[model samples]
Target: MSHEQLKRTALNNAHRQLGARMIDFGGWDMPVTYAGTIDEHMAVRTGAGLFDVSHMGEIEVRGAQALALVQHITTNDASKLQIGQAQYAGLTTPQGTFVDDLLVHKLSDEHYFLCVNASNTDKDFQWIVDNTKEFDAEVENTSGKYTQIALQGPRALEILQPFTNVDLGAIKYYWFANGTIDGVPAIIARTGYTGEDGFELYIDPNASEQIWNGLLEAGKPVGIQPCGLAARNTLRLEAKMALYGNDIDDTTTVYEADLAWIVKLNKGDFIGRDALARQKEQGLTRKLVGFEMIERGIGRDHYPILIAGQQVSQVSSGSPAPYLKKNIGLAYLPMSHVAIGSQFQIDVRGKLTAAQVVATPFYKRSA
Candidate 1:
């Protein structure tokens, strides 16, 4: 699709006004960078950065059977979520393949919100509707009605404290609160994709511009930069976070993706619980691991992974770390080859270079 034909976010004009380089991100016209990728990445690490995340899907499941419906469709133990609490989960088919990864937030006993990936929004909504037909849950796609903005970094809380009346200190990680921002009702969650203290604000699309401007004005002194997808990717990679279509896909299983924590085998009978339990018993054949180049090479997506003398897997996502100043990447390989300090070779530009398997999380901020 052409750039002009792609979907635009509520802050599309603002991004353009900032001279951002726009690109196709999952069919949506989104900013790839403003200023520069490395500079934006460092801004989040040292200070705070703002992100327009309105392209994400917000789905609501409400009814008497909402809890039961969510428990059946997701691999996580939804029954454990308290009001205003959120948990990362996965929607999987009966064959144990991932449909999509999502975040389940329990608003009340009969109300729940699911933040899903943008690319799979339509498919996920249809899947939920088709599956919930047997139950009494009412599924609604509220993506178009809301806009999400992420204020992420070490100074995020300080920057956002002056705008809302909510108690920022009381709102712990993975918790949310319904409050007003400049007279507009908003749901603010103390969660973020980057491994830092931040908040995700969900507000009416019509009121997004006001809130964005308020934040920018409030953050002027703290050095809050408007970041784009380029910084988002690098920040997530430093935290060892997974990205869909790169780190995982429909063909990849939870066991192979090293996300077995999302699968609750004993949480009643979920769609993929049985198959995942069986896989656990049989042991995983392949697993994703973190690696760093020992020689001069920049690992990237789809790069070949050679073990001993033969190709075993491929790099899923990688980048030259602006923080670490080294090349790092994630890749899937045989279970027997995924040990700390294990030796391997990565094919960078048709030349094999030595690499070593290392512990994940290339960066972590102080608490």
Candidate 2:
């Protein structure tokens, strides 16, 4: 898509005012970095960093059969969720590939909220609607109704506590509270893509600037910085969090992606249950694994993997993990190549370099 066709979030002007370097991300004109990616990345690790995640899509499912409809479509057991709880799930096609990996928020027994990938919003919404024909559920594409801000890092709680009367401490991971943020209606969830103690605020688009500004001002004492997409990507990679388009997609099966935990086989019939069950019984051919560069070369997405002079697979997501201070990446290799210490060569820019399977989550915070 051309630059003219790129979508802009409510914080577009704010990012520009901060002199953030912009880039087209999945058809959205977004800030890639400000004050350099490494600096912003380190700030989040030691202090706090704010992110504009408004481009993510939201879908609302309500009505008497909402639970039934959600259970039928997603791979996770949505029935296990209680009000105000959220669970990571995948909307699967019957063939057992991901429609989209999403977070399902159980607002009530008859109401559920889905947070979907920005690029898959329309397709996922239509899929849900079409599948709900057998159930009495009302599915609404409410992506434009809210703006989301993620306050992430070690000092996030200290920074966000002053602006809301809602007891932020009481909200546990994967749980949310419906309250006002700076007197604006919001859903404050102790959830984040980056592996850290953080909260994501879902508020009206009109209140985005206010919340963004307030959080920054309040976080000044703790050295808060405005993070961009570049930092977000690196942070998530360090934590081994999957990026939809890169680490997974419609062609990747949940089992192959090492996301079998999200597929609840005994949760009663789901879209991909039968295929997943068959795959489980027969065993997997290829599986996702994390690897580190042993030689001085940075392997990147789609870079071919060679084992004993034969090309076996390719990289999915790779980079020099900022906090870990090492070059690492994720890839789908043959099951035989997935064991820790297994070695291979990565064809980086036509030059072969050594690599080895390593433990995932390249970075972990101190307890």
Candidate 3:
């Protein structure tokens, strides 16, 4: 679909005015980059960057049974989440396949918010509502009620502190608070997808443009650039973060995706608990692993993985690391060959190039 036909965020006009290269991202007309992907990526890694992530889904579960409803649908132990804290989790199908990964924020005893993938917004909302029918909770699809902006990197706090009266210092990582930005009531969460010390600001759609511009103006002196989806993808990939539809999908299991930590099989009877438990005991047949190309070639999505020169699996997400200056990617291979230091081959444009499995988070910033 054309960009004009796609859904627009509050900052859509600003992005276009800034000469951003816009692209159709899951029916949303979003910027891919303003200056360049690598430049924006470096800006976020070294300094700061702002991302207009208003396309993501915001859902609310409220009632006496909110906690129980959420815990039953998600793979993580939502019951362990205290008020104001957030936990990364996956909503899995009955067969233990991931429907979508999300961040569950415990707003209160009877209220919880789930930030879900942009593309899976409707599906996730429907899933939650359908599943919660038996519970006393009420589900609301709040996707259109708010716009989200991620101010990421080391300087993010400095840029944001000036606008809000909230004690920025008191807001710990993975926690949130009701606050105001430029006189606009909002929710500020010390969370991000880029693996950086950052915050995601949930603002009223009416106040989104003002906040976006205010952040850019305030951050310009500190070298904070308005990043786009291109940089966001690379940044998350470098951090070994999973992306829906690419790294994980409805057909992919959380265990095979190396996200077993989020699957709380013992957290009572969750939707996928039994299947996940079986998989855990039986062992995963295939697993996702990070690989770096040893030869001179860039491995990309769907690239064939070879074991003993025979095709074994394929890459799910691949890109040249702008930060590491190396070609890196994620691929699913037989569990036997997923160990670090295991050698393999990847088909890069019909040529079998040598590659090796390596530990993830290819780049980690110093504290």
Q: Which window of ten consecutive residues has the lowest lDDT sum in model 3?
A: 1-10
RMSD of candidates 1 onward, in order? 1.0, 1.0, 0.9
Model 1: per-residue Cα lDDT at residue 92: 86
Report residue 269 deviation for candidate 1 (angstroms).
Answer: 0.5
Clashing pairs in 1: none
Q: Candidate 1: worst 10 consecutive residues by lDDT?
A: 90-99
Clashes of each: 0, 0, 0
Predicted candidate 3 versus true structure: per-residue lDDT over 194-281, tens digit per residue: 9789999999999888999999999998899999999999999999999888889877899999999998888899998899999999
Give the Cα lDDT of each candidate.
Answer: 0.90, 0.92, 0.92
Which has the higher lDDT value, candidate number 1 or candidate number 2? 2
Q: In terms of TM-score, how similar is model 2 to the real structure?
A: 0.98
- TM per model? 0.98, 0.98, 0.98
Per-residue CA lDDT of candidate 2, range 1-367, in tens? Answer: 8888999999998999889999998889999998888888888899999999999999999999999999999999999998999999989988788899999999999999999999899999999988879899899999999999999999998898888888999998999999989999898999998888899999999989888988989998988999999899989989888899888888888999899889999999989889999999999999889899999999998899999989988899999888888889999989988999999999999899999999877887776
What C-alpha lDDT, on a 0 to 100 scale, does residue 75 get in candidate 2? 95
